[model samples]
Target: MDKTTIICRCEEISYEEVEEVIEHGGRTFDDVKRLTRCGMGPCQAKICTGLVANIIHEHTALPLSEIPLQRMRMPLSPIKLEILATNSTAFSAVKSVLDEVEIEDGKVR
Candidate 1:
């Protein structure tokens, strides 16, 4: 596979980036996640976690079972802004929380 080939479309992570993380002491899924944010996107690792594991296995020659999978947190369902906006209760609830938080350049402040 091409180094620049995109592995995680949601986060725009490439195979090369993942390899670099491994080369730099990333031994597990979470390690790669912390170093490169590979699976922390809208899809939440649903797509790329397997691919990442495969890469790790290929590079380290580790058994597939030995590579730890990324943990899935709560809020499995994606709450869309448009859907929330259409519902007053949901919108208000989200808006109230958002009011207290500051988001700049896609990062929460």
Candidate 2:
């Protein structure tokens, strides 16, 4: 049986490309993103995050939860770098709310 693979439609990435990134120390969410552009397209990690996370876990033998989640900024979506850079104040908000959140008895609070 022949196995076929695909990556970003816009970037025409291949599974090998993504796998290679993971193989080469690209473990964290942003690391994979920077290396493979897997979640850098218009879909902005929405479509590819789960797929990429699964791939990373499979290749690295890391559990799903152990993998560092992609850091989601305020927008939870991609925005122009310039716009973000210019509005430094907008980025001031914690990239994620870690304090108010309470993890209780191994369950989210």
Candidate 3:
């Protein structure tokens, strides 16, 4: 793939950036995400997961099954803070995420 080819469109990440991350010992999608913010866009990894997986496979010889999937969260669309503040039952999916958080020192991890 061309280095300038857009991989994660939402974040405007390019193939070169992704390849650089892999070359620097980034082995997983999350690793690339932390380094380049590849899959954390508005569409999340939904659009770039397979493309990134392919890149990893080509570079590292890792099998598709062996590649770890991106950690997806609930609530695909943006929600207002007021909705969360309301504590209403509508955003239960978001609530589930809050419930699953690992907190330490009164901070979310």
- Judged by lDDT, which candidate is best? 3
lDDT of 3 by residue, 1-109 (tens): 7789999999999999999999999888999999999988788788899999999999999999999988766566656678665867656654466688899999888
lDDT tens per residue, model 1, 19-61:
9999998889999888888888888889998899999999999
Error of 2 at 10 (Å): 4.0
After best superposition, candidate 2 residue 84: deviation in angstroms? Answer: 10
Per-prediction CA RMSD (Å): 7.0, 7.8, 3.5
C-alpha local distance difference test of each model: 0.84, 0.72, 0.87
TM-score of each: 0.71, 0.62, 0.78
Tell me the TM-score of model 1.
0.71
Q: Which scores greater on TM-score, model 2 or model 3?
A: 3
lDDT of 3 at 13: 97
Q: In candidate 1, where is summed lDDT lowest over 10 consecutive residues? A: 89-98
lDDT of 1: 0.84
Global local distance difference test of model 3: 0.87
- Candidate 2: tens digits of C-alpha lDDT, residues 20-77: 8887888877887787676777776777777777778888999998888887655577
How many clashes (backbone N, Cα, C below 3 Å) per candidate? 0, 0, 0
